[model samples]
Structures are given as structure tokens and as C-alpha cells.
Target chain A: MKKILNSADTFVRDTMEGIEAAYGDRVGLLDGDFRVLVSRYPAPEGKVGIVTAGGSGHLPLFLGYVGQGMLDGCAVGEVFASPAAEKMADMIRACDRGAGVLCLYGNYNGDVFNFRMACEDVEFDDIETRQLLGRDDVASSPKDRADKRRGVAGLVYAFKIAGAAAERMMTLDEVTAVTARALDNIRTMGVALSPCIVPKVGQPTFTIEEGQIEIGMGIHGEAGIEVRPMMTADEIARLILETIEADMPLNAGDEVSVMINGLGGTPLEEQLIVYRSVHARLAERGVAVVMPHVGEFATSMEMAGLSVSVFKLDAELKELLRAPAATPFYTNANK
Target chain B: MKKILNSADTFVRDTMEGIEAAYGDRVGLLDGDFRVLVSRYPAPEGKVGIVTAGGSGHLPLFLGYVGQGMLDGCAVGEVFASPAAEKMADMIRACDRGAGVLCLYGNYNGDVFNFRMACEDVEFDDIETRQLLGRDDVASSPKDRADKRRGVAGLVYAFKIAGAAAERMMTLDEVTAVTARALDNIRTMGVALSPCIVPKVGQPTFTIEEGQIEIGMGIHGEAGIEVRPMMTADEIARLILETIEADMPLNAGDEVSVMINGLGGTPLEEQLIVYRSVHARLAERGVAVVMPHVGEFATSMEMAGLSVSVFKLDAELKELLRAPAATPFYTNANK
Candidate 1:
């Protein structure tokens, strides 16, 4: 594979080393388990600790959120592979400050099974915990089966809101409630124009003819809903917005936050254009946008395309999203 | 070409629309001139205002730096084409306060010609202005011929340091002096693995054989120092670090900042891996890295590769680098 790495076998470890080297003041690996990354400064006494974990290849996703106003720790896995249950348990135990912990992550089968094992593994710690999975990808499943949906860019909202609640000294039950509410308000859809190769696989995860697009593709190159000829930026933005609205309808006078996340290879300019369209469409619907994010919040390792996420908001959600946060890849100081 | 644009004709303006839509609260298009973007909250009275201009396609370049505590205004151009002198004059006039304005941008032929014309055009306005060019690419020219070097990722440093000097209310001459010092102490180099397709051009800027790399290539696909087979991330990092050291030696006990900038399509995971290597190599020589950045700061559109920039800093320079600055795409809340 034409990837800039020393070796495929050590890809994840090498990436983690670089991340720790660059952001040591902010985050580092847990002492007992190298796969678990914890914030340098733990939460205050009696404050619930927020933790997350997921596969690799998506920067700013699993570990990039660990910091002052965000996640407390995270368990990292190999590229697109789930981490072990013991690592998750180690993260939970380390982050527990006698205020319990929250196991937040995506809705992948591998991740779901491991998180279950992790909760049982930490039962003796006497620290109550809650499991909240981000199931915001509306295109993955119908409205009646939202639990089966794959979490995508909207997972970022879950991290921000949940972390803000915990940082504000919310109890474990309160933090879980707000996180679940935030997750329920999020709806996301994506379009992919090209495939990305896994360094170890040395091949494209999937293929499409040049000048075509895949609708509703999973981050790990799972089959999208359909393959069709490429559409203009505005067309793609409108289609994604329409689909999201169909599922989580944003009516007149409603307010929300919008995110146009790039799937790695897309340029920031293009993502902004997509954001412009999304905002314009929302404005036409009389919906106000509070804190909008347009960049590569989550990516599929150089895959070409973008995802649009809208989080319907209330006063509390707005304040939580705007809470001061400082992480290596993300910083929202507009408190 | 596979791009998410509405049309190649309106690429620049459409992108500008998106940018203004997203960051309208922080920046807006200059009245009576759509090509010039000025900060919403201009610099305080009597503070030196900073303005920069260059061709488009490089997001977070000229326009992305225009906001609070950064550039006061910027003139936007068509993709890879220099903006007209009158537009630059408009930006200069809009940003100029009672004190003066600083014209800091890359040392490009068209940009140099236009900035000169722009200053002369606004001379009748009776507002004093100073010109500073960024020339940090060591691959384009040797140290003795540094003036002939092309600006690349190091231009971001110029914007940040110079903007910080201006924001802190330094005198026009003083800001110019510190900016010149920062430019003198900086060095940058890059390698492009594949070509980027310009929107209107409808073709690759330059072509390379598969799995090959163009060492020291320019952002606009300009020919590099040489072409060779792709090397491992560690080898590439060492080669670049050694080359930079050969020209500007970094001895023991040296303190500086490092940046591993992705060229557009490269994954963040890969960039972090490269950062890991660069940091390890620097540490081997007893150099201390502060405020290391690993992401897409300045980029060529959809190009596959990355650039490394090192800013050798003194006490004052380090403080300025750590100063708080916030733009739409770049935010340094760390002070």
C-alpha cells in the first residue's frame, strides 16, 4: 500500500506514539494498558468520568476527544478493529473517581460485545457505569430500527455534550440522560465518491467507477445504499439534508447545530461549500444554526466524500455544545 | 475530474460564499468589493492592521487567517491565479487604521508584483503600509539564495507570529522587525506523492508514476528538487529533518516548534506517524518541541503528500507563537 508508515504491523502503535508525543501535555496512555489513553488531569472528586473507545483510522474520533472539557479517557484499537474488553475495563477503572464512569462509543457489533464484557469486568470496582452508544446514522436503518443504525459524524456531538455535562459535575445518571438525549437528537447521512485502502490489506475496501458516488456508506467501506452518477455539491447537500429531515424533521422556528464532516480526502473548501448549502437550506426552513462545525471531524482514511449531521438543540444543549473545550484536535472556546 | 463543485467557473466565488456563510460573525466580505474579506471585529484603534493576499485553492491560507488576533483582512483570487492589484488595494484600505497596515504574504512573482501595485494605488489614501514576504522553503533555494525560495506551509507561521505582533499593539516597524526575524529563523520542505487536479484546468497539475514521490514539490504542483521512489515514513522524516538541519543546524538544548502539515488527502493517522518520527529525531538531538501541530494547516487541493515546518524560536518568539488566535479553521485558545 502507498501509505506513509514504517510497517503495517505497527501502524496503530506508531500512530499512538506520535499522538502521545505531540499531545503529551493533554493526553497519554494509561500506565497499565498502553491501548488506553487517559487525560493528563483527571476529573475532580465526585465528578463522573467520561470515556469512549472505537476502531482506528478515524482521527479526532475516539482519542482526539480526550481533554479538559471532553472525554476523560479512551481505549484504542487497530485500524478499523475493535479494542479488547480488558483495555476498556482498565480505562473505566482508571477514570472512576468514586463518581462512576460512562462507556460511550459507536454501535458496531464488535464494540457492543466488548463494552458489555467491560462493564461486567468492572463490576467489583463499586463504580456505577452506563453504556451509551451513538446511533445517529439514519441511513443505516429505518426510523423504526434506529438502534441498528451506525454512528457517524453525529457521534462527535455525543462526545461534546456528554463531556460537557460530566465536566459540569453531573451525576452518572444525569450525564447518561443528557448524552442519550443528545444522541437521540442527532441525524446524519453521507456520500462517498472514492474508496480508501487499508495499509495491511493493500487493496481498496470497495470500488466504484470513476465519477460515481455511494450514498450512505459506512466508515469501514461497507456497502452504501446505492451507486449513482456524481451530483453537484448543492445536490448532494440537499439530498443528505432531505434524508436527515425526513427521519428527524426540523420544522419552522426550530434551532440546531450543523456539521459537514469530510471523509478524509475531501478538501476543506469543498466541505465549506457543502456547509454553505446545508445552512442555506436550513435557513429556508426557518431553522437557526447555533454552533456549526465543517471539517474532518471523523474520516475514513483518505476516502473521498462528506457527511452532513444536524443536532436539533434546546437551551441546555446549546450551552453544552458551546462549553469551553480544549483537546489536541478540537477546541471550542466560545463559552 | 471528480470534484464536488457546482461549476469550475464559479469555484472561487462559491467557496467564498460558503466561508462567509459559516464565519459571518467573525468575518465578512468587504462592502463594495466581494473579493476582499475583512475581520468583523477589526484591530483596535492605533494597532497595526495586517492584510495578506494570494490565489485560492489553498484553504486556511490567505482568507482562513483573517479573524480576531490574526490577519485583519485578505484579498481572494481565482484558483492558482493572482488577484488584481485593485482588490489588494481595497483590502489594504479597509484594514488600515490610524496607525498603518502590514502587507505580509508569500514571495510569489505575481503576488509581489500585485502587492507593489496595490501599495502604490493606495498611497494617495495617506495610510502608511509595510510589505513582508514569506520565504521559508529550503527546497526551492539554498540558504545563500533564500530570497529566491518559495513560501509553503511556513506562511502560516508568518501569519500567526506577525499577526500576534500586530495584535499585541506593536509599532509598524517593530512588527515588521519581529516578523522578519521569525521568517529568518524558519525552514520548511515538502514532498508530493501525487498530482492535484485544478477545477477549471480539468487535468492533473503534474503527473508522477504510481508509488513515486516528488521531493520538495511546490503547492501548485511546481517541479521539486528531485523525484524518487517512495520511502517509509521514518526514512522520509529523517531525510527531511537532516536536510533542514544541514542548512540550519539545530544543536542540543535548542527549543522550537514543529509542524507536520498534510497536503490535503493524506490521513491524519499518517501525519501523526510522521510527526512521531520527526519528534523522535529532534529529541535524539536534545531539542525540545513546543506547540507541535499535526494536521492540514495549509494545503493544495486534494494533493497527496505533506510538508514539515520548523520554527526556531527564542523566548519572545515562543510567547508570540503561543498567543491566542481564532479564525474559522484555526483556533489556538492556548495562551
Candidate 2:
């Protein structure tokens, strides 16, 4: 393996230690569990607490979003592995501010099982928490089975709207409602040119032959809908948009927020290329892009791929999306 | 040759088109020169124009900084090549708003030569401008010959400070003076686990044997002072700090801003690991870390390595460093 790491055995702990050291002023470890990272800026009393938890390989996903206008805490698991239920419960306890907590995460089986258990554990403590699953990957399921789809880069939108709602002191139910609405409007699909290596594995989670690409691969190297010879950026953008539009059915005059996310090894220059095609396709259909984000938002370890996410916006959702946010990996001008 | 690109000849233009398409609201191309990207938000009538430019491949460097509280314009070049003098002059013209422009970039020979020519060209139009060369790579030169050092991640510091100075309506000379101060206080060093592939070349610029690393390597695969067996993150961090301290002589109670920049392919998890060591080393020396940034700031086209930059700060520099800034790849809370 050509990775620059100390050892597979200590990878997770070392990384967490590093995270805490680097962001000491903004974040802190849970009192008893280091895996549960909490924001140092305490949430306002009576404000809903926002928490997300999942595997660790995707930086700025679960932990990187914990800040003033985003997540309150996150339970980090091993790379591509779900965190334990106990750890998730600890994260909930750390962030609960008496107004109740909202648990949000991707719809992976292991993540669902563990977060559900954590919700139950938190309920036992009378924390009064709610849950919302992100199933935004249109290629993972048919339109009728949207709830079965996996979450991809669209999770960042959920974090933004829901966190803004919570920051505005919305009730837990209101926060959950806004979060679900964000998820409903979001649709994401990805194309992978190469695979990512989990540190512990010391090898690629999966492989792709040279000059070939996999459409709709999950972040953890999950099976995609199809594999084909590599195509131009324009062609790939069309394929991803068509798949998402078929499921969500965007229309003329529709206003939407777009994200072109790089899956680790892909450079920002190429991500912009993909975004160019996406913008052109959307404009051709008379769909107006209100807010556009182009960069590595969610990623596999070092996978060379890109994902496109479209979040159809309403007045309420647009306001929440434009709200100010500050995090290590993401920040927006309130204007 | 495992790249997701269309053609080498059209790569730079295609990427620039994509950038304009994605960020049309905040940025736009110069009227007569597509290679020059200028901010859509107009600068104040007498505000100094902050401009940066260099070769392509380093996304979020030249073009990404062209937004509020940052760069006013950027001239772009082909992959790993200096932009033409004519293009640089066009960028200067687009950003000049009565107040003079400040031209800042790394101390590269080609860039130096071309930018000098561009300066002469812009002078014909009676635009007052100043130049500040960044030379922060300590490994590139001895302490007595610091001007010979190559600029790496430290260039980002120069951008942040000078951009803030310009935004605060500092005079052209004032912005240039602060930028030069920032460059003097900064030092950087990097290690490369592997080389980057130039898209046009379709091959790695250089190679490293498995289980080995090159310390103090340049961003463009330039030769380093030494190659050695890969070591643990702690050992590597110690070596880097020792070398930087030997050259710059960091002292106790010194306030510094630290940036752990991923060259390209290094994941955020690993970058955090490196940051952890950097924080600990500074703390051990009783040096105060004022602002810490860890991520892919200035990249080298998906190169599998990272660079460490430390900028010692004074009261005046600290205020500018903490000033509000919004860019595609970076944002500050402005607290």
C-alpha cells in the first residue's frame, strides 16, 4: 500500500486525536468517549440539538459539520464501518440541550441499525429525540422505493437546512420536518473512475479497469447500476442528471441548488468541468440554478470519482440553504 | 493514464468554462480574455485590487480567491505553465478600479519573468501596481538566502493577508507592505509519497518506490534534499518541525498561524494526523497557534503528498489574518 499512515491498527484513534488537536477551539471530544465529537460552542438552551453519525472515511461529512450553524455532535466510526450504538447514544447525550435532539444520517443498513438503537437508548433517558434517514441516491432505488436509496453528497444539504432550522430554535418536530423536506428534494448520483482504499484494508475496496467507469457507486464502493467505457464529461453529466431527473422529475422554471462533489482523488478543476455540463443541461431544460457548490464535499478515502446532487428548492428551503454556516470544511456568506 | 478527461489540448479552457458556469454569480471572465477570471462584485472606487496568478492545476489558488475580501482577479495559465504576459496584463486591467493593483504569486522563474513583462505593459496604461514575491519553502534555500526559496502553501497566507488589506481599503503600498511582511514571517516544508500526473502528459511527473518518501519535495515534483524509508506520522512531523525551526528559529510565546495543506491525493483524515503533530510540536515549544487551517488549499494535481506552512504573526498581522474572507475553497467566521 502506498498510503502515508502509521499503522492500520491505530488509524482511527490517531486520526481522531489529530482532529481534536487541530480543531481544539471549535470542537471537543465527548466526556467519556473519544469517538463522539461535540461542538465546543454550546447550543442555545431550548434549541433542538442536531447530530449525525456514520463511518469515518468521509471527512466534513459527520464530524466536520459540527459547529454553530450545523451539527451539534457526531459519532465517528472506523473507516467505512458504522459506529457502535453506544457511541451514538453518547453523542446524543453530549448534544442534547433540553429541547430534544434530531438524529440524521445516511440510510446504510449498519448505520440505520445503530442509530435506531441509539435513539431508543436516548429515549430511555427522556431526551425526546427524532430520526430522519437520508435516501438521496436516485440510482440506488426506483422512484417508488426512494426510501431504500443510499445517501450521497445530498446529505450536506440536509445538514444545512436542518441545522439552520435547529439554530433558529425550532422545535424538534419542526427541525425534523424541514430536514425530511430537504431530503425529499435532494437527488444524487456518482461516477467512479477508480476505487478508494480503506486504511485497515490496505487495498482498494473495489476496482475499476482502466478506461472504464462505474455509474452510481456508493461512497463505500457499493455496487453501481452499471459499468461502461469512460465517456466525456458532458456525457457523464447527462447520464447522472437523467437518472436523477427520472426519479425526481424536475421541470422548466424549477429553481434548484446544485452540488458537483469530488470523490477524494478527483481534482477541483475536473469537478468544475462536470459542473459546467450540469449547469448547461439544467439551463437547456429551463431549470434555474440558484446556488451552486463545486468541490470535494463528500468523498471516499482517495477514490477518483465525482457525484452530482440537485436539491429542488422552495422559498422556505432556499432561505434555510442561504443561512450562514461555519465549519472546518464548509462556510457560506450569509448574503 | 487513468484520468477522466476529454483531451489535453482543450483541458484548460474546458476547466475554465466549467468554473465560469458554476460560479457565474460570484465570478466572471475578463471581457476580452477568457483566461483572466475577475470577481463579479465590484471593488470600492479607491480600493487596491488584489490579484494572483500562476499555472493551472492549483485550483482555489488563483481563481478561487477571486471573491469578496480576497483576490479581485486572477490570470490562469496552462497546466504547469506560466500564463502569458498579455493575459496577466488583461487581468490587471479588469481589476484596476482607480486604486492600483497588487500582483502576488510564488517565486517561480517563468512566473517572475512573465509577470515582470506584464507589469511593464500595465504601466503604459498608467496603472500604479506593486509586486510581492512569495518565497516560503525553507527547504528550497538556506536561511541567509531566503529570497531563493520556493513558495508552496505559504502563498495562501500572503493571499489572505493582502486580500484582507485590500478589502479594508488599504493603499496599494500599504497592502504590498503587509504582504511582504507576511512572506517574510512564513516558512514551509513538504513531503511527497508519490508524484502527480500532469493531465496533458498522461503520466506521473516522477516516481517513488513503495515504502519510501521524499522529504522537502517541491509542489511540481522537484527534487528534495533527501529520500528515506516511510516513518510514522509523529516521526515525520518531528523532522519537518526541526528543519523549519532550524531555518526560521521559532521562539516561545510566538504567535503563529499553521496550515496543513494536502498536496492533492492525501485524505483529510491523514492531513489531520499531520496537523495533530504540528500542533503538539508548537505547543511543546510554547509557541501559540493563533489560527489553524488543515485541508487541501494549494494542490498539485492529485499528488499524493502534503505540505506544512507556519506563519509567525504580530498584532497587525493577526488582525488581518482574522479578517472576514469568503472564497470558493476557504471561508472565515470573521469573529
CAPRI grade, predicted model 1 = medium
Worst 10 residues of 2 chain B by lDDT: B326-335
**Largest lDDT belongs to which candidate?**
1
Which candidate number maximizes DockQ? 1
TM-score of chain B of each: 0.98, 0.97
Over B1-335, each residue of candidate 1 has an lDDT whose tens digit, in order, gives 77888899888887888887888888899983658889987577888989999999888787888887789999978888789999999888888887788999888999999999999988899989999988888899887898899888898888889889988899999999999999888899998887888899888867878778889999998898999898899998998998899888998999989989999989999999999999999999999998997899888988989999999999999989999888887877731
Candidate 2, overall lDDT? 0.86
User: What TM-score would every model get versus the actual structure?
Assistant: 0.98, 0.97
Model 1: residues >4 Å from true position, as ranges? none
Cα lDDT for residue B252, model 1?
Answer: 93
Q: Each predicted model: what fraction of the native A–B Cα contacts (within 8 Å) does it retain?
A: 0.66, 0.59
